[model samples]
Target: MGTADAPVILVTGASRGIGKAICELLATQGAQLVMAARDGEALQVLATELSAHGAPEPMVAVIDLADADAVAGLFKQVFNRFGRLDGLVNNAGVLHEGLLGMIRAEDIDRVLAINVKAPLMAMQYAARLMSRTQRGSIVNLVSIMGVNGAAGLSLYAASKAALVGATRSAAKELAAKGIRVNAVSPGFIDTDMTRAMPEAAHARRVASIGMGRAGTPREVAELVAFLLGGQSTYVTGQVIGIDGQMVV
Candidate 1:
């Protein structure tokens, strides 16, 4: 358990990759974690690992963010368990690539539900709680695909672009309430999702980066931590990209 005075943070998609890295880093800052994801087993394993390492014991929430309604349940859990939320990382997202003609209706629904709707609703819930205390920070995980526009990822790009807009608008609306909202738009991060891309597509992505390599999850997490932490208190309504110079 963290100290009673420790900050409480809710991280969606907390079982893997950038989400997992965010949890680990935030825990080190003495933040009590509400780790939400679809993978119960993975969440448990990570909670155990963090606890063993002397971080605060994490509360795991196994939920499929694709449901969209799950965001309400997650916020309820947070309020009932912790009574307050000091930070939120909306990191749960899905990426389905297909040529425009090949895209299915189901794919659009699933991707939008997870990537856009859930996060927006999560922000709604978090905003309510944070407004009460007059303190909070929210970091939305966006992507360069949304800004730079990927060929076969039109739907995914649209969803993320929507979030980028939401981030800025939320920041404006929430600023007077002492709540902040920002986005971290990463490009070509080395995660399981990206690794699963077809070889040629993956190579093409890497070849466009000025760094000549994909970024790491930890690097993205570091930026999120900064935005959530006290280091960047004056920052909000911004979409910061960590793409290593997308030369494309």
Candidate 2:
């Protein structure tokens, strides 16, 4: 059994992208992991990889984040098996492209359910767990689009903005319990999502970033580890942008 000295970090959406990187980083630090995502086969593979890298085998929960009942079940499993949760990474989200007028209501609702409602439920449950221990951290994966409005991303931007607001309120409400809440807003990153974008659109997006290139998942993961770890004990309710100076 992992003890308090070994941080117990729970990462949602750990099958790929930023979530995958975060799990690897925390695992490298000897943190016991409780990995959750919809892809069961992928999550099992990642758990094996983490164990190979010297981390204890991670507990896996394959559930759709959009399902509120499934999310509640996940937390229940965490409490039952882990007994304490040191940190939570609410990194599960979906991005649908289209202007506000062009997007269908169903698409918007889907985005909100996954990106906004899922995280909110996770936060609510995590807060309860942390309050018991009087120590924990929540690192939200927001987006740079939320900071500066991006064309054709109205629904996505609005969901992230709502999360930013939730992060602040949660930070304040849970401060006394020693729970630090913050957000890491990533700039354009080279991932499965971006690789799927049209070539011209990707190039245009890269040009807007001062760094002239997209960020890697590992870079964002490093920042997330720092915030979730004890290094930022005094930091709370802040949104740190990691977008390669894209919005500056």
Overall lDDT per candidate, in order of appearance: 0.92, 0.91
| RMSD of every prediction | 1.3, 1.2
lDDT of 2 by residue, 131-242 (tens): 9989999999999888687899888999999999999999999998899999999989888878888899999999999988999999999999999987899999999999
Please report the candidate that would top lDDT against the real structure: 1
Clashes of 1: 0
Off by over 4 Å in 1: none
Q: How accurate locally is residue 132 in candidate 1, as Cα lDDT from 0 to 100?
A: 86
Model 2 segments more than 4 A misplaced? 1-4
